[model samples]
Target chain A: MAVQTIGHAPASSSHKGMSPLRRREAINGYVAILPWFLGFLIFTAGPMVYSAWLTFNSWELITPPRWVGLANFRFLLEDQLFRTALWNTFIYTVVSVPLQLLIALGVALLLNLNIRGTNLYRSLIFLPSQTPVVASAMLWFFIFSPTQGLANAGIGLFGIPPQRWLWDVNLVKPALIAIAVWAFGGAMIIFLAGLQDIPQSLYEAADLDGATPFSKLLNITVPLLTPTIFFNLVIGLIGAFQVFTPVYLMTGGGPGTSSMMMGLLIYRHGFEEFNMGYASLLAWVLFLIVITLTIIQFSLARRWVYYEGDRD
Target chain B: MDTHVSPEVKNLQGQRPLMQDHAADDTTARSRSLVVPRKRRAVVVHLILFAVAAVSLLPLLYMVSTSLKARGREFAYPIEWIPNPAVWRNYLTAVETVEAMTFFANTMIVTTLTLVGGILTASLAAYGFARTRFPGRDFLFMLMLSSLMLPYMVTLIPQFVLFRELGWINTLYPLIVPAFFGGAPFYIFLLRQFFRGLPTDLEDAAKLDGAGFFRIWWTVAMPLAGPALATVAILSILHHWNDFIAPLVYLHTRDNWTLALGIRLFRDQYQVLFNLTMAYAVMMTVPVFTVFFAFQKYFVRGITISGMGGR
Candidate 1:
């Protein structure tokens, strides 16, 4: 309906003394964007609305759907697994996002020095991030293997005792966090681009002021880099919240549901158990949380994020 | 100004920067003391970078090493950094156990079709948004962008049901069809920025030659967008090659599974045989690594352009 309205409104408005060239352009514009518009309606907006409706009903993919008002949402509130998934996802997001950003920033700073073999170093660092998630998870699984794992062997050199990683309930989330952090190369590359964008004159001006490297980093680099930081932060938060693959493959929210994540929970319910209604409800809850947090971040961003050319 | 200059003068002018660099080098040699600390710092920087790079690559290196190790020795205590007797058989076993050739074929088919569809559709939509104007254009673009924030999980179930109704389940259509429509919103945004940055003078000249909008776009705009198109192609290849969830949700039967799904299945079936699993992982990862290395410049440029959009 919205698509039809927008499509017709443009053509109708063209009749109000609009020139022929402008009318042609308007029509061409609609035609060009038609594919994406159709996709939005079918894959995105339509499914979203259908998902909301399914949340209010019970459908097991066999029988006809039955309306059960507010039942899914009510059960979602009290579901212990849902709460565990939420808390686990929240903790993962809170810890991993900032930690990954910080690591990326540090590596980016080092690479920005333009040292010899900078390209080689950058390529090596970023290669892991390109490793398929399933492969990366398997790699880390071997790395954290308790008996013959490289992790224990490396710790053994330091005289530290062996620890079960993905198997131990207490250690599973932290292990997952470490695996997530290992893929910070993507963020690192973005930060490297951001670092390169800072005008050399700013650093030169700081040099003229006899600024120490630390102070220069504090005043010039960090302030100028805030926008990039904000971008990475938002992207990182959104990604970290929806972390599914590694957890699904490595731990499967195992060792007593210690590592259950929201994405995995949705998958379990919808696909595994054929409980689409409850899965939709859980997904909606996750969506609301992400949206609320994103909004909060944006509001808070005004206080700290620096845009170079902004007047206000 | 150039016309007044003789050939000799022009040659001298060309050499001026080289002469200046020599003079600067002489001064820097004289101030060798000043350069020493800087050189030392450069060494320290190199050392730090090397250490970090090595650590960053350690996991992948370990993966390669384990993949080559004898099966039972994969978890040996004193981890073998280099397997003395390399187990090339593990790769064969991994491939055979999972019927990986079939999966690889499926993956190639999905990836190639998705790449073709994604690039053509996303670039078309991007050209429309960037080069054309219509009522509510900005509103429509913003609406598209805002949809990026919607979690994929919210749409997963409904889409599954929709495709199931269409009898597209256990087929590659669910994974490939949407790509034909619009690909991903992010790709469109990236291409839109690129298309906007291109000059319009050529298009204007084409228009004067009686070229239509579609002709100008195909001959003028798309040709000039080589770097951006390459970027989109590389990203699409990597995405479809690595995508797991979509294929997992849609392709139920083993006959239709992609390489990603097959790798997971390999891991599940051969969980204890870390060597075989590592081999499977390595096999699946090589193509992506090759693509990234070959198009390293475009990949970095694409990311830089995306970051620039935030500004």
Candidate 2:
């Protein structure tokens, strides 16, 4: 306000006319976002660069880093645990992402129906998502227990013998996918919003076409809802790749390292073994995988993800 | 500017997605919504939705029931849906033996500090991004949003080392302090979107009144963004209260543990007692439940906004 020269300039003036005011505002912009920039420098950028540096070297926490170019990545290719962890994460994601999207979309469809008590139902569905991962894992740890767990009890009524859930190498991933589905309301709400945005007139048009319910869903709802599904897919994949808290609390990477997801594997190498260099290498690998997946997803959106007015 | 779209999908949905796109359509299924559902069908829909909601809620209900069970009742032959005689002592025991109250208090501290810091920085930065005439604003905004995709794994080891160097490894500082520096990119983005949606007449009026950037933002924009700010606050509660990975990594001491870490430690300590583990979960969950019930509207809107940002 003290700088009278730049004050109250004519609106929509040329840049030459409002240079000082513009410059001041620019400085303010930078200052406003400066804290985040500093955070990026400290917490994200520097560490990320260091992490990249570590990938080329081997350093236990105490020792100086020793160059071991490609050794960590090479070892990861053949290392049994890394392979298992990678495979576990991939399988968990491949199975769970679709399951979660499907469940969420289905529930969102139900809630989107002009039914009564939608809020109550939505709240009940969302309740699990609000619980901390540790608590849910703890609760589900007991529920999925082989002998006395409620899941087993429920299945036993149909004479299916109680199965080892998280402890079982093969079933552990599915068990996790199930838990992911149980907390589907987060995405469900998103889908509800998406559903709201879809024109009800489309349904009326489908009705005029004599489309079947399943056909209408497949043709109309599913196609229109692809963007939201894609969003959830990308976010969900990133989240699933970093699955740790539940694994840490429930399985501890398992009965025999069966449930060893990549996150836990990284934690083990970095913190437990004090092998910072190797952990950084693995972390870089995870980072690349995530980045690549996101890029691929975005690129593939060229084929399936619809924007209402993007065509030329 | 990073928008994406399928060229054909845009053209395709214009006319129709039916007919030529498929021959495998399930022609047998009736399009129910074309007509109002009969009373019988409505009952079926209600029943089905009820069942789905019940399944969604089963784990939570079981957690509460198990928390109230007495000795030998937990993991009994038949899974009990209700405790025979609810033992309120389990709650007392959880508080007494574990000092669970300490964990809750610690959680409150972390959440409060992070919430305050996060909202302030995010909203301040959001005003700049939305309202100020910033050179390279778009590019910098992209830079910040890009961090959302950067895997925390890449930063975990180095960040731990950095925090250790700063002597913040075992304290709440690692978790709470970064938040002051606009740690939440999603919220920053959300608030920026929100701030942009506000009518700018007040800002212009304040500016003509010789109010500087800070005053215009503080006196005009902030007051108008109450709903958006509440949404940020709500989402942050959802995030910070249930945070596990941060607490797991940062806080090493039992006494310093947030509720998430404390209950985890508690569960392991009482591994044999399923009911006792659940009691800890119940204790941790109650406050979150209360907050959710209190602010249900904001929770829904905030989550929707997070998803909506991609478009």
Candidate 3:
């Protein structure tokens, strides 16, 4: 009755016509979101469905897509280079994600200190993270060159011998991990924000009871910080799994596929090799691995992640 | 955009005054007795931070120094840490040999369009999801968010085909057009969260004044969403400017390349020329620092507001 009374006229000028208020709102909503809806349909949803089909069909750009069910998947299982790429990428992600998180959290804790010039430190630390990935990848190339690199030059300052970096097969992924860890500023800022969100009263109460700083951190700070830690862990995993540009630009998956990630292999198959079916299959496999990892993380998250009001 | 001071930010606010009080207490305590320990600790903290800053910024310094060093000295043994004769012509030469100006202009066109178009489309969609009352709104929004979980690799192949069929291949159109439609799921979600945080009173007043939906959106919400819009704009610019894969896939012509693509091509063309490639790296890297420094506050605020996994 109130809704009917709120409007001046019926939307369609008939007794059974919808209320002008409801009709107008529905129209406005459709009009407002239509651009993205059409986009979501064409660009995202439509292509996703099509890419699935491409996975089962062998198609180069010029040729008609030929059906070859299961063959693409079979190829992936047997491809030696595919296995190498998977191994290399896993090593990179497993080694780097935890290391990155620890450093970022430590930096965040430092920045959270009630001290002057924290903002300057935050900006300085985060500055490297803002460098375009392509540029950073190129910068690392110079840093990794055995004879003439900054890595060697810096070690020389400490009276240590020069070392071959990414050029050496054994050291390539480690060098990439080291480079990856340097860009932890993004995660650090998130941790800083998370630290700010922890209630100060908890700390003050702990202080009143004469709690040691380290004990307070372990008991209060770490427990309260599980959600942010989980957030970084998930994001870092997704990002690390898709390591591409640096591998492609710096090494070309080289020194015998020592640094090839699944993404670079997929790129090589689809674009460089012109085998779209195999590439799409590889991509789908990558997608599934990421999805499974995410699902596992979420199920695990239930054990540790605490919402502020969850207890309440 | 930080419309709600969550318990954590509130805690931070409370803690600052407490710290200041501690500092005051320290001063009084020093007058009464010993303050040397706390002073020494603060000095140690500063020294540690100084070391980190040097390590963090060294690669950047190397890039710049290499770009400026006299031509052959870039790879000199016992390296020229501070280029002896900081020759600036590498910049001029890198640009000339690579047609980098063309790449820059092309990148600007694509990035600016993406920024303007993305904000408009995403903001409109966000308003629909956040402010308007409609049937199936929650369902539709969930569907939209689900796309965030769908890896771009899954969609990359057919999207390339879509553009190829549209004859947008080897041009900036492939890069620019999708943004005009919806931009990205992340940006749409960010803007939606921003819109949801606005007070209901503004829209209620607009309705009382008989302002229609579009008018209310323009006058009431848009006016108050400057910070959110700016954050989206800056993020979009950064993403588009730094995009490598899209340009690498779509753009085959040197003239159509963006700065990222230009650098990759320049690297291949001068693979062993450390100075030239580093010069290109410097050119690509400098703008990111500029934008980040200028808008660091807005960037931080936006992240805190939306950073809980952007869900």
Give chain A TM for each model in order.
0.94, 0.89, 0.92
Measured with C-alpha atoms, the lDDT of residue A203 in candidate 1 is 68
What TM-score does candidate 1 reach? 0.91
- Determine which window of 10 residues in candidate 1 chain A has minimal summed lDDT: A1-10
- Whose TM-score is greatest here? 1
lDDT of 2 at B217: 81
Sort order, DockQ high to low? 2, 3, 1
Off by over 4 Å in 1: A1-14, B1-34, B267-271, B304-311
- Report the lDDT tens digits of candidate 1 across residue range A1-312: 223234544443543566889878877878888999999999999999999999999989899878999999889878999999999999999998898889889989989988888999998988877788889988898899877698888789999899998899999999998888888888889998889888886665444333457766777788879989998888888888888888888889988899999999999999999899999988888889889989999999999998876733
Clash pairs, model 3 backbone: A197-B8
Candidate 2 lDDT, tens digit per residue, A196-239?
88888667655544455677677678888898888898988888
Name the weakest run of 10 consecutive residues (lDDT summed) in model 2 chain A. Answer: A1-10
Per-residue lDDT over A1-312 for candidate 3, one digit per residue giving the tens place of the 0 to 100 score: 113222333333432354777768878988899999999999988987788898899999898999999898888789999999999989999999899899888888877876678888888888787788988888888898888688988888999888888888888888999888988888888898899889886776555333456767776788789999998898888888888888888888877889988989989988888898888888888898998889999999999887665742
**Residues B1-311, model 2: lDDT tens digits:** 21222344334345444452132243334434334565555677678789988998888999999999986788888877878888989888777767678788889898999899998899999888887765456667778888988777778899998898788988989889989998488889888888877887878888999999988887888888888889999777767788888788889888888888767444444355767778988877788789778887886788776752111
DockQ, per model, reads 0.34, 0.40, 0.38
- Which residue segments of model 2 deviate by more than 4 Å? A1-18, A205-215, B1-37, B267-270, B307-311
Model 3 per-residue lDDT tens digits across residues B1-311: 11223354335233432343454445555444535766777788888887888899999889898988876687898777788788889899898888899999999999999888898888888888777666656667778876776766677778888898999999898889899887787788888878888988989998999999888888899889999888888778878888899899999988888989877554444356778878998888878778777888777665554442111
Best by DockQ: 2
* TM-score, one value per model: 0.91, 0.90, 0.90
The ten-residue window of minimal lDDT in model 2 chain B covers B1-10
- What's the i-RMS of each model? 8.6, 7.5, 7.5
